[model samples]
Target: MVVNVSNLSPRLRQLGLVAVLFGAIPAGLALMGGGYPFQVGITALIFVTLAVSLNLVTGTAGLLSLGHAGFFGVGAYAAALAATKLHWPFLLTLPLAGIVAAALGVIVALPTMRLISIYFAVATLGVGEMIHVSLLNWVSFTRGPMGIRSIPPIEILGLDLSGVIGGYYVAATVAALAIFAVHRLTHSYYGNALRSLREDDQCSAAMGLNPVRLKIEAFAVSCAIAGMAGAVYAHTASFISPDSFRFEESILILAMIVVGGLGSLPGAVIGAVLLIVLPEVLRGIGDFRMIAVGVFMFLSILFLPKGLLGEASAIGLARRQLGAAWRGDIGAGWK
Candidate 1:
């Protein structure tokens, strides 16, 4: 009981911190009781998962993807179709959804390898829109606008997580795992390579890094995470439509990472929570809620250009500079 937490390995400390933070969300929700608040909490957790997954590509690897919603939708429909048509267990369909979406990510990455900057972003946008349209027209498979219905509640280990609090717990758990995985990724050697690829793909290639292969892997991993999030969303809501996964939705997700800090893991979670909560808190504003949200986002970018968490980092950097100066280490740079 008197353990020295500060002495723990960095990895263990990170795991402990993340577990406590995520665990608190559900615990707080449970204490607050259910209803609209409960639903909002669940929604926040879902987006936290999505934003974290998106960070794998956009944040770590610097791949701009306007088509993440497509991957999300793909995973949703994959699991939905599997559950509906094949009568597969919900647990089994989760990975199937990820695999299907990841395969699509790979296919998209193949063509994207040749493109860069806005072209690559545009390509991803096209890919997302294509997926959205295909879902709209593929009535035999997706049922088009009618969407997939009657998706059963998630059942795991003989316990059904169909209820409000149950679903929240499940989503929170998934979000926690996603955060931990992404944290590890951003701190790992592979993650370092991804950051290198993001900064200079050509230079990284010259240094023996395969830019194409790394980019593909990042896309595939990012999409797989998105797919899993979508599958969880589908089951939690018990239904889904093509409308939920759209270009605008993709933009919203992209905004989450930008406002959160492009390469910051905590930034993703913070951005998701703020964006998700702000909308609901402004629901009383009726039609003007989005306008308020847009204004808020505009201000965030204007003042905190590096992002909220990024701004904090900038402050920390300044403090570090001051500290070095105080320690008489500042003059070495000019030498």
Candidate 2:
């Protein structure tokens, strides 16, 4: 039976539509003779989590952070420390990583919350660099540039994930949870406060909203989600280090949110997948791969404007457009 879409609330419609399509992709891929297709699909989930988390600041709070990689690193390292050294359960370590990142976020936000726009981005850049340098110099914590390898895989009820397929499920579940949480938050009164602040801080404050608390809360929550994604990544890659969560990583997440139509969750996912996995699709181009990516990204920013999905949505308005055309439709478009 065809699932009903096109009339639900924006968030509900988006989430349900995604759920329906996601369940079918694996079976279709299998029917088409693809192996372990869910693995790539799962990676998209993890990346989406990172992007949406970044969306909180860039989208809702109107704060541009150039150093989100710092929080992502914090989460991965925390998970590494807990699972490998402390011998904690994988389940136990997952939330702990988020907590660690949240704590760090609070500390960083307290100092930088007063800044905005370019100054805010610059301040976060410094904070991110400090995190990266700390990971390198504080060998005892991060194990230095060598990074923490041999990360333990997730074990659910004592069943260890033996392949990428299982990883897809785990990543998808985490990503779904993050999506729901973000959706709930965005619809809440606090989310309204954030949007108000994003539009105009002085007006938001004049109405008696505490920009500092709201900004700090948004930063803290965003960092926590980044940390959660990082922890998931550590397990998926079975490794960790300062190098993996560098400035580029932060920029990639920022691009995901920015290009995906800013404050939209579905936009975040679409942007992440295009930026993260599409690179693999271009890898066969050899030396031109990076160049193609640059060009594609440039074109996406120029032509797509909001993002690939955003552009696709604009093209999807015609009743004659179905299937292939729909695939080209970027529903992530807003405004």
Candidate 3:
């Protein structure tokens, strides 16, 4: 079942909107007060943006990329270089990072167009490793292992956003914008084309949709959004290195999309918040923290096979309810 907001009942639509608006309150409060909690909020917003961007390819286009961190790193480096070397303003660097990352996405997409499923995934993993090595080896450009330092914080229109409060606001605003953009994209005809490609590329192509073009476009858009998030992260933290955007980071992001519910927008946000906050919440566990995390994920997969927000199981429940209604099963609660 394709779950479009327009297809939902008016009451459900209003409820969803209310829930979305209310969800912003906690983050806003955290930002209003600066502290460790505020810091965590900033990081959560960044991950939220990344998760949404990754969903474009992984969820909508059904492309499992294991190297999204490569594009993310590219964006961070691009922003850093522009700020440190070219002395560009923060505003300019944001788009520059996205453009550079999108270019890399195109490069990656071209070679992997003929591949799909596991083959495509493996190729992306290799691409991520290549980026990591390049960042480590390209000393003069990326400053090698020492990473970029003293990177200036975001400033716009005579306002400096280096403070925790300002940083959180910026991160939240960017994340909100990213979510809105994805929502618009996913509701359009183009989104349907991507979904069709995900369901069956050959069949979509037979119906006159161009799978290759759609896939490449999705990848470019997704990576570009990731790059924007990276730029925000670099400016907010005022430091970035290749280690920050490694294979493990990619895996964590993949986990966010999966645990949140693949192909669900709200799922991206939920997954980002849950996973990013989960580690912090588990800090008391000390040596066994990761074990707990692994066990939790195992159980989630075992139970919510399609993910927490995935439609497959929801559709099943809906069908059961309708069937019960047809048979006059009053206890089923269907009027």
Q: What ranking emerges by lDDT with the best candidate at the front?
A: 1, 3, 2
Report lDDT (Cα) of residue 142, candidate 1.
Answer: 91
Candidate 3: which pairs clash?
none
For model 2, the local distance difference test gives 0.79
Write model 2 residue lDDT over 1-335, tens digit each, in one string: 77556544445755665676456655665675554456667667788899989887888788999999899999989998898888787688889999999999999999888887999899999999999999998987778989998888888778877467667667877887897688667644676688889999999899999999989999999999999988888888788778887898888888877677777666887788887777767778778877876787777788867664542352233212223322435522111
Candidate 2 residues lying further than 4 Å off, grouped into runs, are 1-4, 7-18, 28-39, 308-335
Which 10-residue window of candidate 1 scores lowest in summed lDDT? 326-335
Output the TM-score of candidate 3.
0.85
lDDT of 3 by residue, 1-335 (tens): 77976567645764675465445655555655647777788899999999999988998889999998888899999998899888888899999999999999999898797798899999999999999999998998899999999788889877988887788778877888888788657644677688889899999999998899989999999999999998998888888888999999999899888987888777888889988878778999888888887787788889987788884543343334334343453322222
TM-score of each: 0.88, 0.86, 0.85
